[model samples]
Target: MKNRLLRFYLYFILYLSPALAFAQADVPAGARAAALGNASVTLPDLWSLHNNVAGIANLQQAHFGAYVENRFSMRELTTVALLAAIPTAKYGSYGLSFSRFGDELYSQQHAGLGVAHKLGQFSLGAKLDIWQIAAEGYGSQKAMALSVGGQAEIIPDLYFGAYAYNLNQAKLAAFEDERLPTIMKAGLSYRPYHKLLLVAETEKNIDYNATFKAGIEYQLLQNKFILRTGFQSLTNRATFGAGFIARHLLVDYAFGSTTLLGTSHHLSVSYLFSRRQAS
Candidate 1:
């Protein structure tokens, strides 16, 4: 059974994943982003290190987060990640992130250092990533890539965000100009009420068709609990999730389903510590 599953996974990677570009590099990191259909370009949170680095410019406290995801209920397809952010009241924010996906047969790793700075109502950020791709019995390849992002408050309660992954178009292999996936995303987020949030985004891969996504989130009990739901167009997936907050800790879980790949489960935990005082 394991062998068959691994083979299927290989086939999916080679044939289908290109069409679902999100499966490749720059994958969504946290459970919150997954639960929200990846409409996270405008969201400001820890996972922003992987989504839109600029979003982290809003952080006023130090944060640490860990995340895991089991794709299609397969251990071989699991992904694990760790992230940390430090904010300097006068200098802006800095972050570190690492994530690994897949099993021994095939795997990908990303380690990145990022920085973000706020300029009045607008924020800008960038990350330098060290990436490694490995396949059993075939060795591994390493490369570096740069990513940049920006976010701005367009109005009192609305935000606009955009990011470009692999801005330098780093090469993965020498053959046929084979390179890491380059993707672009833009989105809007609106907070019509203190407790209600709505998001919509469009993503494009240089080699694939554009995709649309949207999500909604609601907070209850004075911000102690949260509920979220979202949809993706091209992938035809629906996602649901909830979050709980206790003091400085946050826990989130998400469930996503698709006709092609079955169901996936995602979970994450984050802790906030020490707010930076304005200088």
Candidate 2:
């Protein structure tokens, strides 16, 4: 029976998967970031609420965004996220983010509130995150994590960024030292021309091998249309994406492929409440 098979699959994952290796569980969101192979620490966008919190400081207008990603064409591996950013006159930017991964059989959810302050060419940010894990048969576990990030424009057209996720090493369970993934990332972004941008970054998780990523983006039609491509060393995945930007609304889509995981698709949409003019 289909229902019988589904139940068996759930039991297999819940009991056997963790023992093999506990997942990092820090799912990345946003088609733009995915299109760029996740080399996004320095890129500034609405979804920066999930990438580098400090990157939101670059926004001058209020923004709201929604994102969805389907990995390996599996509904159970899909991720959905909602994000918002509000910029102030004297203060910096405030951000809120919510994301969920997996289906009812198993899932992880995150809710976070963050603020980023821009100080001249440098910006700093911190977020308080509540993480929860739930399973169909088992109950749920919740913990708090702290994330911090900073971005700096080193020179004209060059920028640097770094972020620390789950710096406090929040615990998931007392047995087997089960805990949330703690990750650190640092990267650089360079723009030689207004139309072309390049990014490279390295990420390290205490429990896994370091991952290196790089991406290239080009804009056409005066930034109304954009094209992007990227590669990740961790999974040997190649990603391609494109974006269409109107006056207030932006839409982006990404496609990625790997020999092991088949393929993945990501799509995101965002709206800017108002455009900020130069003072």
Candidate 3:
């Protein structure tokens, strides 16, 4: 019975992957980003390397992060991610991020290099990624993709962003007869009150219905702690999360649930060479 279920799961993921050209990744970006219902294109931090490259400009010092997520409480479905970034006043910010999903039976890994630069109130960024997909019985394949993003501060506390991933629609493998999805995203983030933030975004893909995401984060205890909640339209899921900060160390936790997919839990830890300033 377990064998049958595993086979079914593997085939399901494969169908959603190369065959359909869906851009959804098995490993999500980060717990904090996930908590924002993955409406992270405008949010910045060390993990922005995987979320939105332009947001990496928010980093003022070197940063490192580790993240993990469990989907439906399955070990083989767990995801692990690592990220690092260095920001310099002269050259802007540079980042490297990697993530691995699944076991040997069916696994995928992503390695990415990204850079972001800020000019006045505008930020521009780009990234190159290598994706490796392996199936125990099927042949493994590798592909490279490129992404670019930009963000502008319309007002002091309001920001607008645009991002596109796999912009060239890279082919998975010629024999596979599939092309990567070209996903375009746009969003705005606003801070109505000193301690409250709100974000909304829309994502479009050629093969899938457009998705709308919205999230809110509130700071408590003078930026040492936080609370977040959000919702996604396509999956009809709600998410809740919190963050704790101590000196240069950070910890984040998130929980998400859908009608059909049960629940997912995520945790992330990160460190910044210099602490962020409070809003």
Top candidate (lDDT): 1
Residue ranges of candidate 2 with Cα displaced over 4 Å: 1-24, 276-279
lDDT of 3 by residue, 41-138 (tens): 88877877887899898788799999998887777677899999988877789999988887767777888999999998988999998888777777
Model 2 agreement with the true structure over 1-279: per-residue lDDT tens digits: 996686577558654655222352566668999999999999878887888899889998999999999977777777899999998877889999998887787788889998999999998998888988887787888989899999999999999999998899999888777788888999999999999999999999877899999999999998999999999998899999999999999999999999785999999999999776555
lDDT of 3 at 25: 49
- Least accurate 10 contiguous residues by lDDT in model 1: 15-24
CA displacement after TM-score superposition, residue 87 of candidate 3 (Å):
0.6
Ten-residue region with minimum lDDT total, candidate 3: 19-28
The C-alpha TM-scores of every prediction are 0.95, 0.93, 0.92
- Residue 49 lDDT (model 3): 85
Ranking by lDDT: 1, 2, 3
Candidate 3 lDDT score relative to the true structure? 0.83
lDDT of 1 by residue, 1-279 (tens): 997977776656753343332255788889899999989999999999999999899998899999999988877778999999998878889999999987777788989999999999999999999999887776888889899999999999999999999989888776666678888999999999999999999999888789999999999999999999999998999999999999999999999999888999999999999776666
